[model samples]
Target chain A: MDKVTNEMLMAFVDGELDPAMRKEVEAALRTDPDLRARAAVFEATRQPIASVFDPILNQPLSLPQEGLRDGTEQNRSAVYSPGNPHSRTPGIISWFSGLFQPPKTLSVTVAFCAVFLGGLGLGFLLKAGLVTIDTPEAGLVAFRDDGLVAAGSLDHTLEKYKSGSSFVKTVSDGRELAVKPILTFRDHEGRICREYEITYPATSRYAGLACRTEDGDWNVLIQSPIKSRPTNGKDTVVASGRDADTVDAVVERIIKGDALGSDQEALLMNKGWRGQD
Target chain B: MTEDIRERVIAFIPRLRRFAFSLTGDWDRMEELVQDTCERALTRHEQWKPGTSLESWMCRIAQNIWKDGLKSKKHRAQVSDDSLHFLTGVDGPREIEGRLTLKAVMAAISLLPPDQRIVIALVCIDERTYAETAEILDIPIGTVMSRLARARQALYAGLYDSDTSSACAKAEG
Candidate 1:
């Protein structure tokens, strides 16, 4: 047989060689120290390289909420149910809605139809400029000059929903948006801040952290468009690149201690966030 | 059909993330690459033909996006430093030792030329066969073998030959 090259050794190590070639290499390895050492390099580097990135697979998949956009209520419900273990937990969404009925202190009812119509009305008003948006970005039209006030269904959800609860709002244009509060933590200034993710169906996603002010309004402290694809549908967005980093940096900066537990969040909600201050 | 494709793309995310990490060897860059890959795969999904390997197709998109970004950016020098921090941040002696070794492997992998690096990521890390890797990267089987061999040699030298630590000494012995 001709001299076994490094390429051939590598192929042999990878189990790509036929049985005849494999036996030839095995025979050479048994006799030739130099050839064995060369093959050893290929063998040594294989498993570590394969296993080094295994940790990433176990980490949470940070996907944009793309596939959940175009579905019906039943489809959306099924996507989050326990049967679909891959989907993010639906417990968080249903728990808050179940635990706290519409805020009795507030005038608005908790009915889905009423909230939908209210959100539709507010969406039209925002579009008509009757309500000014201090920062008008896609998936973030709810902000007002007084701070980042949640309008319509978002307003109701923010006022009543606990951390991890998610609700969908359909606007006048028939676009369905999913809003979910991800974390609840107190900031260094003793204000209760909630980090949230808003997904604009077929368009973009926005992540923001808003603090509840003394007046009981959730003021947007920071909001960034974390992901946006090109309208042409060809070019790709960097997904959760710098924008997500910026939001994370802000969260790391102002956040005090850990995020509130589900029980802690529930207690704070029951208190109407009053006596804690 | 688009909905099915989208679900399949979502399912392929964990593998794509692993492939992305192998390519970039930095957490932040790996994330960016994965996201970019997902967006491209989801948006231009029609370009992906059925009956082919979706995992390989997505990986191809990730490599292209990473290469395009590389063209505009400077070569990374901070990956090793970040890996060091990651290594030390963990607790438990056994876990720490494992992570330290893994981080060293990753740092070494990061230093390979991008071509060799991608080949390693696909063939070695992702466990794709030579022919499959050739198909994914659109390279000949001969090219894949050569790159894989050279990359493995470089990685072995970087991990063992460059140091006289007990681990290296044990491996060599």
Candidate 2:
């Protein structure tokens, strides 16, 4: 017969062994002083470990305010927002169940970094009147200025471009900003929106959504920093970066339906950027 | 149904908080970690398969999120220092008493490395099966057993001397 190993004793102690093995171990332990001593040590250690931490199970904790949705309530109110604490933002996990409409164009430039969705430390691209220091909140999240120009550029690009054509525009500083339309779709609120990424190698890079207003002007709903890979270009620069959580929150909030298929996007473009227009 | 999930998630707060405390060993950071876990779980709740263990899924999310936080150099430094404080400097000299008190036991467990501590907490303290622990920590069951065995040995060495062991044997016998 093989000698009894410590692992077998542990398996016996932890009830991990099958019934035949357990019976064998029990019989072996009755005749073996060494195995019993080792088993006692294991039991002794296990008991104290439980006694030490089991008290924690009884300690009261401040309950979290919200819980996970089981996809039964797909259109439920958004309860989690990244930037604003008072307002509820959409649950990020809720996206996996086909609850939220996926964005048409997920920008390849912004590499996803892990960040807490609630306190998104935004790096804003400063343009004109949009730059302002945020009042310090309870958390240590820092908001930096470097984001609005990219946001505005994203808006303009969505308005001017057709389905297949690329958009290029000159800002006030004469820097050329190019926007490539990934796809266009109508949101849950019936707003016609286009998802695009603005790449200005010299100035900044941004990925955002541009929604058409009633008067046909484009408005940037959300924008975040683009992380350029080092191997792609030697001249790439990142002005500000958003974490994965913030990006997901933004997408969850604005998207209302599936991304437009190629044919659907082309048909919409032929009828003009807005089908009504 | 959403409300039921909300209640169930809320119920998990204590266990999550305790697990967080074990990882961080700081009450404030533990609470923050738990809060972050809840937020992440809610946001990504759609990804959770309906019939599987919710606790294990949430624990996996928490472990991954914490691992992500550890990627920052500053956070890694802080954790290193905290581990040293609890494991070596504070608890080493005082636990030589013949009896094993709760404080001594806790200090002994705290002396473990983070990975070992996590395995100990999941398997020994929380009474999770080895398979469940392996799933939660995203390690193999073999690794879990080895870490757990090492942790048990450390605890026994820390808490038991000849006098304590003889006394325990005497009382039990």
Candidate 3:
């Protein structure tokens, strides 16, 4: 074999050369003492240089001035909910949210009925299927698989909801919207709950509920969008905040807790949860 | 706007912070770098063109931000050559070679010429491939190989020279 070039040696060290080239390089290095020395030097040089810093992955993130100013707690809850209302992604979102101070306390009584909404989650190496988002500008409902669920997008399977006085809007076919009122009140365990239903458009859609905290941020409680308006017994129901059996159980939990009584509703209204749009 | 996209970016920040720290070697600065990079990635969503690797693109932005800000920090190097020598060399002292070998790596990187330093950070430490790195730096693929080789060599010399190799060895040990 002709003398192995330095490039070939380096490439071999890097595992960049194909099998035939690697075999040729290896055989030459074995026969020549000089080639073996050079290969060792190259390999030694390729070792990692230790850094001064230890793992800084969880160090406190520095909030930009704009992020601090714009991301008020109320605004965060008001706008950013990804996936659907019943989305399972809230845990991840909450994890991300805990990094910064909430802009305000929750005020669901003041929670406004209308505005733009969105959500999303992040991953270390993002794939095509996973959602991509920073802290959202709206109330977000996230799912375990890391997808965002939009608010108006879930208008089709409005049947599951039965709110007492809360406003509901669902796209019906192309031209119509099924509107209704909702009743959202805290149960005995202090978990606030909402019930409502809407008929959706032909397009796929999602839905969810948000409970505001005193800090002015909306803690996303439930995000469940309809995969299909279950035609009857034929549909399979995934267990979550939306499961028919669990819904009444949750409502009962909310009911027996006595937190959703008239006095708490007035308190929620004063805090901005009820008054919010 | 898709739910899928939102969640992915949110999940990415923690690891990205770690990578940025490895690149910049400063926790505060790394956080600032990551937040700005995320903001830029979101605002410039139109520029991303969709269907390409978002992590690489964000990583490229982070590399640029670190590079752009490096020139401004020239005045504040607190550690003396002796301290760095004691801190980074493979065998400066028995106490010096612990987890601090990681620090030695950062110190060596800081000492490198910017051209070599960046390639090392992006390709070697961050584990990005040459093709993705070339696209991030806007250099040719051949340049990635050349720069990476030189960076690796310079890193060995910078990190394991006689003054520091003893302490640096502790890191390897």
DockQ of predictions, in order shown:
0.16, 0.10, 0.09
Summarize candidate 2's per-residue lDDT along A1-277 as a digit string, tens digits. Answer: 3777776777777888889998788777755667777876676666435533433433322111222223334333343332213223232223222222233311210111111111121121122221222111111122224222222334334543454455443222223445566567777777777766655644556666666666555555665656645535765555344334554456567777777777666445433344532
Better of 2 and 3 by lDDT: 2
Residue ranges of candidate 3 with Cα displaced over 4 Å: A1-7, A41-47, A50-54, A57-277, B71-100, B163-173
Model 2 residue runs over 4 Å out of place are A62-277, B71-102, B161-173
Runs in model 1 deviating more than 4 A are A62-277, B80-100, B163-173
lDDT of 1 by residue, A2-93 (tens): 79999888888778999999878776765577876677677667754564444444343221122223323444344333212333333222
TM-score of chain B of 2: 0.70
Residue by residue across A148-266, what tens digits does model 3's lDDT show?
Answer: 33232122111122334322221111122232324566645454444443323323333444443444333444544445444456654332333445334545554643334544443
lDDT of 3 at A176: 22
TM-score of chain B of 3: 0.76
Model 1 pairs in collision: A148-A220
CAPRI class assigned to model 1: incorrect
Q: For residue A180, what is the lDDT in candidate 3?
A: 32
Tens-digit per-residue lDDT, B1-173, candidate 2: 36456545655655675577566655446656777887777777888788888888888877777667777633531333332232222333333222233345555555565567678767776678999998888789888887777767666765675344543343223
